[model samples]
Target: MDCDLLIIGGGVNGCGIARDAAGRGLKVLLVEQDDLAGHTSSASTKLIHGGLRYLEYYEFRLVREALIEREKLLHIAPHIIWPLRFVMPMPPTGRPGWMIRLGLFLYDHLGGRGSLPGSRGVPLNGPFGAGIKPDIARGFAYSDCWVEDSRLVVLNALDARERGADIRTRTRFTGAARDAEGWIATIAGEDGERTVRARAIVNAAGPWVDHVVGAARGAHPERPPRLVKGSHIIVPRLFDGEHAYILQNLDKRIAFAIPYERDFTLIGTTDVPWHDDPAAPAISVEETAYLCASVSRYFAKPVNPEDVVHSYSGVRPLFDDGSTSASAVTRDYVLKLGEENGPQILSVFGGKITTYRRLAEHALEKLAPFLPPMGEPWTDREPLPGGDVGDFELLLSEIRRRWPFLSERTSWRLARAYGSRVNRVLRDATSLAELGEDLGGGLHTREVDYLVTQEWARTADDILWRRSKLLLHVPPGTRERLERYLAR
Candidate 1:
């Protein structure tokens, strides 16, 4: 096979680049060893915000760019992305209140404030104090966004495919050799090994970037990524409102208690240096204790280790800048283009989910000099697939009206998941029975078929976990039934 660009990873950066490159008139092919967003990209705190804590590290440029992209992304993908208000209580011990206020001020104005409301101080006593301790008096509230993180990756890959890019999941890019003309790469899949030619390659392999680099050559790069493990624990909902809390831990790191899956509170994310296999990173006992203690300090109810219902950990591949601590490492991306002689290759390192779009644009610019003249930048102005719906609430209302048989929860779930494409899932079905068998948690066979046919879902986990968080709500035998159905 022949292509213009061969991308090796199915995470946000790789899928984002494929979307951009394919739209720019390039023949793009992306191969992933696992499912799309099977790793780091799916394992975020699921926020699209200018990292508030990053301002403390003087990451002004990074914060500004993220703030700018925050609005752009909300505009382009409103179905899976929407505004989220973060309530930050002024910690009695951490950075003084004045310092936090200054940081919030910068965060509010940095990226040119958009439709979202700005920051303001409020007493942590009334509605804001619902689950808070009595001692903490006041804090600030600011706007960010909540994203269906994995869905974002799938949508990008879907858009890329619609625009002529070939996205091959469960396909591995084993190795590549560069020559004067281009790259001769070998990819392995269920069918076996195959060789393909490409004008260039993009290594966006997330945690395995250095490993991929080694596969291209015989040795690892001089500077490998500093693997920082970030872990999150999900507990039963701690508070009532749609808003989330950003608590400051005594150790200076922050933990968030966000409402998740409607019935659970998602708490997380400790920055611990990791050295083990990146493929399977699990939260340690110490990390779990740390998270529970961190949130316990703020909420009136203390969280214990036993309270955790589920937990996940992802290893971030940060560019080694020699930072003293994992928390201090920069979240900014660095694109390292190969030496200017042979077939061009670009490696991406250390980027946040909020900045993936910008990183994709930058990646293409770096590769532009080596490849054919491509189209101008266009992702910013266009909407991703199914995001063309003008108003989300209006779309939800229409879906409910069209299918009064659907419960409010199901209607909202379908509208949020498929957006304008919900019609395709519903088809001409006038009743729930017509939609096909109820697998579990209202996930019907019809929708599963849509996911399998339209979204490249090959397994039950792809539908339950990554494509949607139905795993948390589905019955115990849901997976087994779905698996059996897929087999048939």
Candidate 2:
């Protein structure tokens, strides 16, 4: 096979670049070792916002760019990306109220925010925060956006595929060598090994970037990606509203407690350095205790380690800034194009899900010299697959009306997960029996089939975890049954 671009890693950065490049009329091929977003891309706090705390690090440029992208993304993907308010309950000991207010003010005005609301002062002692302890007196509420991170990656790849790009999942790029004309690359999939030719290669392998450059493709030794491990814990919902909370710890680090999967609250993200391989990163017991203790400080109902139902960890492939502290490392991506070789390899280091689109645009800008004359940036204005719903509420109502037999909760789930694509997923099915066999926990065989055929779901975990959060809803025995079915 031959293409203009051969991208390794199906994470957000790789898929985003593939989508942008393919839209610009470049022949693109993307290969992932596992499933798309089976790694760090899916394991995130899942917020699409300007990094509020990065202000302390003087990352004004990054903050501003991310803030602007937030609104743009929300507009393009209203079904998956929507406005989320965050409540920062002022702690008496941490940064003073004035300082918090100043940061919130800068956050509001730094970007040219149009659709999302700006920050507002919330009385620390009011009913909105009535559950808070007496020590926390004042707070600030600001706007941000939330996303199903894995879905974002899949949608990008899906859009790329729609635009004549070949997406090969569970395929590994074993090695690549630069020749006089282009790059000769070898890839391994379940069937066998194959070779491909490409003018350029993209190493957006997240935590495996350096490994890919040094070991896989034999590129020049360049800046290494700093591996920072972050973790999140899921527990029973603590609050009723859609708004999330950003709580400060004694160590000055911030933790997020956001509404997740309907009945659960997702809290986490402790930034700690790790020297181990990225593929095996897991949450430590100490990390779990630390997160629970941090949230326990302010909430009326304290969270203990036992309360955690699920925990996940990811390693951030951050660009090394020579900073000793992991939290101080920048989240901004660095795109390095090799000067020695004509077969250009663009490596992305350090990025968040919130800024993946802009990261994609920047990657193309670096590769413009090598690329054929292509169209200007167009993703910002275009909607992702199933994201074309003009009004989310109206779409939900229509789904409920069409599937009057479906419970309100089930209809909402389908709408949120499939977006406008729900129509196709449920096509020609009228009654519950027509939907096919019940796999238990509101999961039917029809939905699983849709995921497998449409969303590239190969295993039960892909459907349970990434494509949907049905793992949280299903009973243990049902999950076992699904696993057995997939194994067969």
Most lDDT-accurate candidate: 1
Candidate 1, residues 389-408: lDDT per residue as tens digits?
99999999999899999988
Clashing pairs in 1: none
Model 2 lDDT, full chain set: 0.88
Kindly report which residue stretches of model 2 are placed more than 4 angstroms away from their true locations once superposed. Answer: 216-218
Alpha carbon lDDT of residue 193, candidate 1? 95
In candidate 1, clashing pairs total: 0
Residue 419's lDDT in candidate 2: 88
TM-score of 2: 0.97
Residue 304, model 2: Cα distance from true site in angstroms:
0.5
For residues 1-488, could you state the per-residue lDDT of candidate 2 as single tens digits? Answer: 39999999999999999999999999999999998899899899999989999999999999999998988889888888888889998876889878888998899999975787888889867655845787777788988999989999999999999999999989988888888777899999999999999988899988889878985454656877889999999999997778889999999899999989889999989998989978888999999999999999989899999999999898999999899889999899888887564768888999878889999999888888876788899999999998999999999999988888788878888888878989888887889889886787778888887777777888888988988788888876777777776666
Candidate 1 versus the native: TM-score?
0.98
Best by TM-score: 1
